[model samples]
Target chain A: MKSVYIVDDSIISPLGFSVEENLQNLKNNTTGIVEVKDTSIHTDSFYGGLIDEKRLTDAWDALSEIASYTKLEKMMLLAMQRLLDKNPQLDITRCGVLISTTKGNIDQLKENNTDRAYLDTLASAIQQFYKLGNSPTIISNACISGGLAIAIAKRMIQAGHYEDVIVVGGDLLSEFTLSGFFSFQAVSPKPCKPFSKNRTGISLGEAAAATWISGSIKNTNISEVVEVVGEASANDANHISGPSRTGEGLYLSIQRALDEAKVSASDIDYISAHGTATPFNDEMESIAFSRSGLEDIPVNSLKGYYGHTLGASALLETIIAKHHLLANEVVCSLGFDELGVSYPIDVIKKNKAIAMQHVLKTASGFGGCNVALVLKKVSI
Target chain B: MMVEDYKITSFCSIKDNKVIVDNKVLYVHEEQGTVKEFTKAIYKSLGIKYPKFYKMDTLCKLGFLATEALLRNAEKPDNQTALVLSNRSSSLATDRIHQESIANKEDYFPSPAVFVYTLPNIVLGEISIRHQFKGENAFFVSEQFDAKLLTDYSRLLLDTNKASNVICGWVNLDSNKYDVFLAIISRKGNTILTEEQLNKLYHT
Candidate 1:
């Protein structure tokens, strides 16, 4: 199989608009999550991480000339443009475009903007505006969509369909999603605490982040090469809203990814888990990791830093994981006061520096979907 | 490049309130009713007792019924079978229902059952659970039924050993409109599934 490397990336979140800023905030132990009383999305108070609108608009206006796009559109476009600006040598017209989201423009439903609620509209608009290589393909398998997008891009590249792919993942917090989670009683009132003894549920957040994955380094001058080695997606075959009692799906995903990456469980230096902080999610992940012989690896969930961003959470966490690999450090799994889950697995508690090579990223979502991707930091 | 060994083992189509398997019509609705009623009527013809059928959204109901007809006679498939299904409108049909539940002023309450089916891929989960097949699955939202995309991706899964078998095709559903086509793919089968074959099966 041909190699696929993470060439360029950008993250737009409440923590910051740039990768450097987001990384600085992570280093400083600053969280984007906070108590939000936005009755527009929910009637009662809820905790979430929301992007500052004024700053977002200001940043977009300074760089982009088009103002017809919605706020989410601007966020995704800006995220992609930042990467495009940094790598002018890359060709937008030749790279595949993959957008991952559970609900795109879903906010339009509440505002009577049904025309924009179609995910195809958002994808086509982005494709036309950027003149992407091909019509964009959307992965909408709940929260695992983002990780599956990267895996799909890698597969397309390996199939020799495209040399590069731009994967942008984003979702907005709205009444539709908020009410759905509320009905399920899955939203936390306070900041989300993944793997904590008192962990309640998820804290819904929103952000748009993009990563430029290339099959080779011939097009641009990128030095830090984090190659996407192995990836697998599986269904729990258990429940739609609940996780499997045995964590079978996630365990299979990890095992398959490890086999594809040609590495054993212990070879994985660090793990960036999909700890949604929900009782079922964290417990399922622990069982999955422990069953896969990943019990002792330092695992951290970025949920506390940025509330579960839905489809963007996996890619956003992956971007941060890349930063961890480059710096050879592990970020603290915030909101985790004590270990609370079935089975036993090492959960990183604080920011610590350590030499890292290969890292594992895993995510599970509604519809019994689970995805695992192994990223290797290699010196060229 | 297609997987040389793979072929379409079986396929079924459920649309126009008719359940057709391998060009044979198994059931057809007679009365004028909503898609939900049509689904219920057709599922009754199967004579199977899976009570969970009634709770699925229209999209999943159609998909489950189609898969049931296609696999009724076949042996149990391996757990590593991958599901690569696509659609045009995605879960817009149920999205509208779920959206309405939350958008109403007087009855403004979300139903977890309806909310769970708001995403298109929940059908994949439902199918996996009913069959106990845990494997790689994805819900792709395309502009339309792209047979070439389905053919190439399905072939890749078999060739790369990502899945021993694959259940792939387009399953689109919206209000008063739906086109569901599911095919069982594997390395040992009678008929090879090319782009042209997929197109033919879609319109079959």
Candidate 2:
């Protein structure tokens, strides 16, 4: 497979809008989950990783072309603009943009009581706003959408179609999702605690993350950059919201990703698991990892710091893992004080020093969909 | 990604435990349960291994039933398979239910469980679990069906040996309407199809 590298990344979450700001907060264990004082908008005491209004406005000003966009669109444009600005060397024409989100401006539709054509309008808005004439692909694969976005870009680049692809994923905590999570009984009253013995449910977060991928794109002296080695998606066909009790879908996704990478379970240095803190999700993932004989690998979930950004989770997690890989350190699984599931696997609770090579990123979502990706550090 | 004979084994629209198939008219503006019920009825009659009641969704039930029928005649591919699901309205029904909760001030608690289905690709996840296919999978959205894009993507997956076989199709459910056409496309050296062939089979 052709090598695909991460050239640049930018993020806007509760922590801050820039990549460096988010990373700095993460190092200090600063969580973006907070109380929403505006309960009148939705009668729920839920926590969300909301972006600051002033920062968001400034970000919109930077990408003034999208000034007319709604709140969600502005948030997305801000992330994209920051990423594009960071990598001005690459020509946008030779690149393709892949946007991933579940409800692409769906909030606007709900507010206006419009029809389904709202999606088309959103796509057009993006095309005109970005000033890109090429066809841009949008993915809304639940929580796996962000990771799948990278996988799609890798396919296009590996197929010798485009050298560079801009992948931007974002989602907002609209009343639509707030009610959905509440109806399902999966919302955490407090901040989410992934893989915690006292864990209750996930905290919905809004975030936008952008990453530039290319064969030629590179940063200064960054040898051993994170490389997309392999990625795969699998369907559970077992349930809609509930995961397969046997972890069949997750097991298949992991197996396929490893096969594509031509690497064995023992080769992986660590695993950035999709520990959603939900009983079923954590249990299913543990069983799947054990089934794959990956029980010994160090693992952690970033939900404690970033909450579940839905479509943005996978890419955001990958960005965090990439930073860890580059720094030769392992991030602890925040909020995991106890092993809540029976499945046997080591969930890292402390930062450990190690020479990282290849790590796995796994995520599972509704409709029994699961995806696994392998990232290898490109050695000098 | 040349056209070849695409077999649709089981086309189901299920709800609760009931299954509906090709015989039932798919409603585009009705309750999700009606669609699920119609799909479940089809699976019951076909004698396929019935999925557990609680674990099945319209997407999984329909996808597996279709996949079972598509692969009934041929053996499972010896190599990994690619899954390409194209759509415009993905998991809208789930989104609707979620939206309703938020809209209702008295009962404004959005259930996290329902929130999970708001994702468009969960259908793909259901399909993967049913077939136990752990391979290259993607969900691409457009204003309308893009046959050229689908063909190109399928070709890319097959040509690169990403998967020896490719199961690509369009599955969408909005309101009560369910319109999906799935196909199993192996390498040209391995399989074959033409527009005339599909037109004759589905039309005539």
Candidate 3:
């Protein structure tokens, strides 16, 4: 397989827009989650982490001459624009864009509904704004779309599809999702506490994360990077919203990824788990980690700080993990005061400094989807 | 990376009141009803009492019918069958309905059952649960049915041994229009599932 490297990246979230800003907030334990009482979403107020409107629009207006993009489009464009501006050496013709989103502009249906509400339109808008050669590809595999996008990009590059691919994933806190989750009772009243004994449900969030992955080293301009060693996706054949009781799909996903990387559980240094903080989701991860024999590894979920950003969670978490791993540090699993699940797994509460080498990132979502990505820090 | 060629061992297409298998019409519905009612009629015609079929939106119903038709009799290891599907519209059919339910505060009652089917990949979960397909799966959205994209992705999944067999095709749905072109891509087949073959089959 061709060596796929993460060349450059950017994140636009409530914590901050740039990668550095978000990392600092995460390290400082400054959660973006706040108590929200938006009438458009639910009858009662719910806690969520929303991007500051002023900050978002201001940053977007700076990059875009006219603010014609939708909220989700603006977020995607901002994240990709930051990476594009930073890496001027990238060839526009050879690069492709992969967009991952569970709901892209589904909010567009709420008002001024048009064909533009479709996902491909959102992807095309970004592609045209950048004037890329290859048509944009949209990965819409529920919440795991972002993680699966990385895996898909790696394979496409490895198969000599494109030398460079830019993946930008984002989802918004629309009434559609909020109402739906509320109907499912999956929204947390407080900021989500993943893997906690008292953990209830996930805190909704919105974020856009962009990463430039290249198949060839010559295409990359970054000095320090992370290599995507292996990745895989699996289905539980279980419930659509509820997780499998045995974590069979997630365990298989992790095993397949490790099998592809030719690595074992002992080789993993740290784990970035998909701790949605939901009763079923957290327990599933524990069982999956236990099944994969990775129970003792230092594991953490960023949902406590960022909330569940749906499609953007996996990519956002991966980028943050890449940053911390490069710095040889492990982030805390915020809001986790006590272990909730039956399986014995290490869920770190505070940041731990270690000689980070290899890390495992796992995510499971609706439609019984699970994705496991193993990333190795490239020694510069 | 070089990958071994796989074949479209079996395929099914559903549109209007007819179901075509491998470019040949296999079943036609004489029932007169709306798309939902027709879907239910077709579901009954198969005589497979999977009661969950009625709850699905037009998207999942079409996917469920076509997939069940393709894998009705053929038995294989459930864990290796991947459900890789694409669409021009990403769950917009159900999204519109979902939007309608929540758009009006006066009649605000977003059914969890309906809201759950708002994602395009939920059909994958529905089918996986019904057939016990515990393997790699993904849902892609594009301007139209992109055969090359589907071919490349399925090849990757199969080549990596993540999936022993793949149920790949397009299941596009709107309020009135619906079409499903699902195929079984496996090692033990005659017709090689090349990009050209996929394009030809998708157009049917």
- TM-score of the first chain alone, every candidate: 0.98, 0.95, 0.97
Find the 10 residues in a row with the least total lDDT in model 1 chain A: A216-225
Residue A218 alpha-carbon offset, candidate 3, angstroms: 3.1
* Interface RMSD of structure candidate 2 (Å): 3.2
Local accuracy of candidate 2 as per-residue lDDT tens digits, A1-380: 57888777888888888888987887777888888866644564677777778878876876685356877777777787788787777666668888888777767656754553245556666787767786678887788889888887888888776889989888877667766666667878888888787899888878988898887645445556788888887767666678788888788888888988889999999999999888889988988999999999999999988888888889998888888888888767877898888776899888788788889999888766788999888765
Which digits, one per residue and each the tens of the lDDT, describe model 1 over residues A236-285?
99998899989989999999999999999989999999999999989999
Worst 10 residues of 2 chain A by lDDT: A112-121
How do the residues A158-227 of candidate 3 rate in per-residue lDDT, one tens digit apiece?
A: 8878888889999998788989988888888889999999999989999999998888667554566789
Which has the higher lDDT value, candidate number 1 or candidate number 2? 1
| Candidate structures ordered by TM-score, highest first | 1, 3, 2
Could you arrange the candidates by DockQ from highest to lowest?
3, 1, 2
Please state the CAPRI-style docking class of candidate 3: high
Instruction: Tell me the TM-score of chain B in each candidate.
Output: 0.95, 0.73, 0.94
DockQ of candidates 1 onward, in order? 0.79, 0.44, 0.84
Stretch of 10 with least lDDT, candidate 2 chain B: B195-204
lDDT of 1 by residue, B1-204 (tens): 444757898889888878888788999888988888888887889887899998899899888888888888887788888999999888889989888887766788689988999898999998998888789998888888888888888888887889889999888877698888999988767888888998888887
Error of 2 at A146 (Å): 1.1
